[model samples]
Structures are given as C-alpha cells and as structure tokens.
Target: MSRSTTATVARTQPKRAVLAAMLLLPALAFGLWNRPVDAQEAPVEIPAPATTLNETSASATAVFAGGCFWGVQGVFQHVAGVTKAVSGYAGGAADTATYDQSSNGSTGHAESIQVTYDPSVVSYGDLLQIYFSVAHNPTQLNYQGPDHGTQYRSTIFPLNDEQTGYAKAYIAQLDETGLFDGPIVTTVEPQKTFYAAEQYHQDFLTLNPTYPYIVVNDLPKVAALKQLFPDAYRDEPVLVGTL
Candidate 1:
C-alpha cells in the first residue's frame, strides 16, 4: 500500500489496535517489524543565521514545508516560545489546500505548518535554526524519507520582508557551511495563503504517537530536538488543541 493509503487505513480503530499491540513487543522486534524502507534523516549541526529579524512584535508567524508536516509540526510544538504549531497547506490557493487535493501533488501546495511564536523568548533566527537543523532535511528535492512528491518539498513562506531576508540569508549561510550532504533546496515563498488542514490532521503526531509513520519517521525528530536543543525543548508541547 502507498503511504497515503496506509495512513488512511491506520486511522481505523482495528488497525490502530493492531498497531498498539505491535508496540508492546520487544524494542528490537517492533523496530524490525515496522522499519520504513526509506532511510531516516538525522538532524544536522548548523550554526545560527548571521542575519536575523529585528521585529519587536510580541508574537510572530512563520510557515514552513519540509516533507511531512506531521514531524515538522511535532518538532515545533515541543519547542520553547512556540505558541502553536498547526499543520496545514501552503504555496497554493485556499481551494486546493485540502489534503485530498494537495495529495495529488499537482495543486502546487506542500504540506506545511504555521508556527506562532514569541520573538522575545525565541527569535525568528532561533526558529530558523531549529527548522533547518532538526525539523526536516532541506537538501532533499520534492521528497523526504518515505514520502515523495512536490507536496513534500522543502519550502519557507515568509510573512514579511524581514523574514524573507532572514530565510534567504540563512539558507545561503547553511549552503556555505557544507554541513548538509547537498545544497539546500528549500525555497523562500512569500505572499502565500496558509489554510489549516482538516481537524483530524491537526496535532496528529501527538494524538497518534503509536502510529507506524509517526513512530518510524517522526518520533526521532522530537528526540533530536531534546538532545540537540535541551534548553529550547519543552516537556509539555503547546498543543494546538489548547490554542
């Protein structure tokens, strides 16, 4: 079955029960049973952007699309100063933002997350640091891990001119670092509309922690965040449900 189809089937109660049972097995056995075919991405150690936004706002919003939003959203939700991390669609029209439509990969929409955060506690540059380092692999083109398509492409939708400059400069800085295996392919897309995904998709990683995809492809990201950014990692994620 395709990833999409497997995800759909996993949502059913029967499949979920089976998955929960699978989780009870020994760690090595469970891992062997559910290992993904695609090699997982490991967080990179990249430096802070030489340039950062000077905005004085109490809160700010940023949109990012890097492969599946499940892991992306999960990573930000556990970060300090992040008010909310919502999985959604960007780089396309509102009408084409639905998962069903975007899944076709021709709607020009990539699975994205709109992150609301406090600049005072965590500057835009800090968020950029977390984004490029642990959230997803920016070097992959039109895909990440087991997923493949334009909908999984790496991108950033800057909300303002300052953010635009910061994103572009940060990508350039990372490219110069030679930290990634390949050049960063993340695009800086501005003036795009961000439509929240369907209710079921919101907070998916937290709600479905035992799901095969979440376990195989996303949980490591949260672990990486805690290990790499202990000061910025929060024990209790600021869930979208509470926002």
Candidate 2:
C-alpha cells in the first residue's frame, strides 16, 4: 500500500476500534449512539429470470460484493436455502485479504460474502433476486449506503461460466426492466480466492444485533428480506461462531 493509503486506513482503524469497544454496553449503545438513517429506498422485487438452470445440484457457493459484507451476510443468512453466509474479502490476492490492508484500497478487494446454499431448496437465480433486492443496492457503484471505497464496491464473483452467465443475464434483465432509479453498475467477474474475515466480523449482524452500526445500517436489510420474500425468510440465521 502507498504511504498515503496506509495513513488513511491507520486513521480509520482507531475509530472503528472505539466503536467496537462501545458496542459492549447495550444501554449506552442504544442511547448514546445515533446515525442518520439510510435513504428510505427499498429493494425492488425484480422478476425471476425466464431462463435458469434446468437443475441445481446438492449445493453451490456464490460470492457477492454489494457494499458492506455485514448487511449482505446478514441478509443471506436469513434466506432459507443459504446454509452459510461468511463475510470475507474477494476479487484480490489471497495474501492481501486482511481487513486493515484491504481497507487501504490498494488491494483491489471488496468486502464480500461467500454463501453456501442448497440449489434444490433455492436456485442461484433466487439468491440473485434477494441480492439485487434487499441485500444491497446494485446501482451504487463502489459504495453502499454509509460505506465508501472500492473495498465496498458492488460486484458479483461467479464460480463458473454458468454462474457468470446467470449474473450477466440478471444485470441485463434488471437494467432493461428499469428496476432502480439509476443504472445498475454491478460487475460480474470470475470468482477468485475468498478469505474469511476475522472472527469478530463473522456473524456480526446476528451476534451484534444491538451494535450501533448493525442497528442503523444492517438490521433493516434483514427485515426487508423477511418482508419482501416471506417464503424464503428464516427466523434463525446461520452464523459463523469462530474464525
């Protein structure tokens, strides 16, 4: 990382560290902390693809970067077919996957979520619907809501050519349908190494339900997922208990 980028991440780390500390006190966390609500824009329920896989196998992995992984992971964890939704770094080298280093914006990594789901229970296109809708805004370019930087970019890292075809077609469908006020900017890239984030970052939304950041930014996405796709919503979330 460049000297300037290192300085930027170094400056950001302390404040986030302090926030982590303050999140321990529930009463204080609720009373003292307040954040501006994200715009009231809701995830639009787009149409399921007319064309989809003729059949899905036992299970598959899909990695998506649509802003902060916390909300994305939280949203997918509530989906019925999703067995696991892990917060991680993708679209970059494996060695530079560490959070602090990636935050400097030189690693070409995006805060992403690796979801393991049963295709029989839910097809990949179903996951894409939730992703395009309640998971995160696909039109936000490199940022999602409050978070900014390439690390939080909107990207879809497909595991294979079939997955890539699905993502590309979906983006085209949404764009053609004019699902959002702005154009969709989500990119479909070949899947690369996905390094799981640190333990504290795992299951963050479930474990830290009352954390200020989760309350203001992430929880609502889960709520929206439940509201928008009631059939697929699961009351309990699959969480990563340890790193």
Candidate 3:
C-alpha cells in the first residue's frame, strides 16, 4: 500500500493485530511497497555549526520538521539533554494542526516535533547536527521514505533571530561541504505555533517499536543516533509520558 493509504488505514484501525500482520510480511515485499527511491539509510557525518547561540536560560526550545515526526522525535528522545520531544504539527494555523487536517497535505502544516532541552548540556547546534545528519534526509524535496506530501517536507521553525541566523548558516555550511548528493532542501520558516498531536502519536516510536512503519523506517534513525553520537545518545529515552 502507498504511504497515504497506509496512514489512513493505520489511523482507523489502531490495533496491534493489524500492525503485527504487517510485520509478518516479508521484508523484501515491504521494501518494494514502502521504501523511498533514494532513502538515506545511513547517517551522514556533518560538521558542527561554526556559529552557535549563547543562551543564558537553562531551558530552550527548538522545532524541526523533517519527514514524519515519529522518527524525528524518536531520535531526539534518545539524546542525553533533551527533556521532552513531542510529535506535533507546525507551519500552519492552530486549527489546521490536527492530524486529520494535516494529513491532507494542504493544511499548510508539516508533521513536526518540538524539542525541549537544556542548552548547557546540549547546544542548539548539537541538536541541529543530529537533525541534519541522522533524523532525516534533508536533500529530499517534499517527502521522506514512502511518505509523499507537503506535510512531510523538511523544515526548521526558528524561535528567534539567533536561531534563524544559526540555522541558515548551518544549511549553507552543509551545502558547501558537498556531503549530500543534492542541495539541502530544508527550509527555515518563520516561527509558527505548534500544536501537539493526539495522545496516540506521542512517543510512538518507543511505544510501538515493532509496528511495521516504525520497524521499517524509524528504528534505523534511533540506531544511527546511538552509533553516530555515542556521547549524546542516552540509554533511556526521555519519553513524553514522563514529562
């Protein structure tokens, strides 16, 4: 099934039995149906931003949209300094942020995550590094993996002028390095209100690790985070439930 069709079905059923059946399908068959034409299966190694923000506050918030929020949130949840990583919608009005509306790809929303962290422990630049490197492929224009829509576009919503400057600089730095085969399509959007997704979507990767979608697409992201950033990776994910 196509990603959109699969998403519609998943939402309607929301049952483990249905998901388990998907898991039983052969991996080859699953790949044929769901994998991206040019998926970034492996994480890239990118340099830290030469310019980073200096924040006096203990807590800071950063929002990013890069493909599905499940994998992006999962990746950050494993990072040491992230206090909370929430799956949500951004780049649209609050009323349009609901999953059902956002799924249509015309809600002006992108599936996104709000990451709350302690800047002292993990710099915004560090999170940006992980975002560009392991969370999702930035070069993909408007989709990630089998998912295709404006809702799956890669974007960064900066909270302030400092973040805007850093994000733009980092994007330029990554582009100049020629690390990615194509130019990074990730965009820096004006800050938008973020609405947390429904309860079922929170900590989805942690709660449903064996769900076919998570198994096939998201698990690799968490693995890459652990392998690529050992110092930043935590053994226990800081789950949304705990927040």
Best model per TM-score = 3
lDDT against true structure, model 1: 0.84
Give a tens-digit lDDT track for model 1, residues 100-139.
Answer: 7888689999999999999889988999999999999998
The per-prediction CA RMSD against the true structure, in angstroms, equals 4.9, 5.4, 4.6
TM-scores for every predicted model: 0.86, 0.85, 0.88
Candidates 2 and 3, the one with greater TM-score: 3
lDDT values, one for every candidate: 0.84, 0.80, 0.85
Per-residue lDDT of candidate 2, residues 116-230 (tens digit): 9999898888999999888888888777765678888889999998888978988898899976878998988795878898666777678677656677668878888888899
Model 3: lDDT to the true structure:
0.85
**Clashing residue pairs, candidate 3?**
none
Model 3 residue 7 lDDT? 49
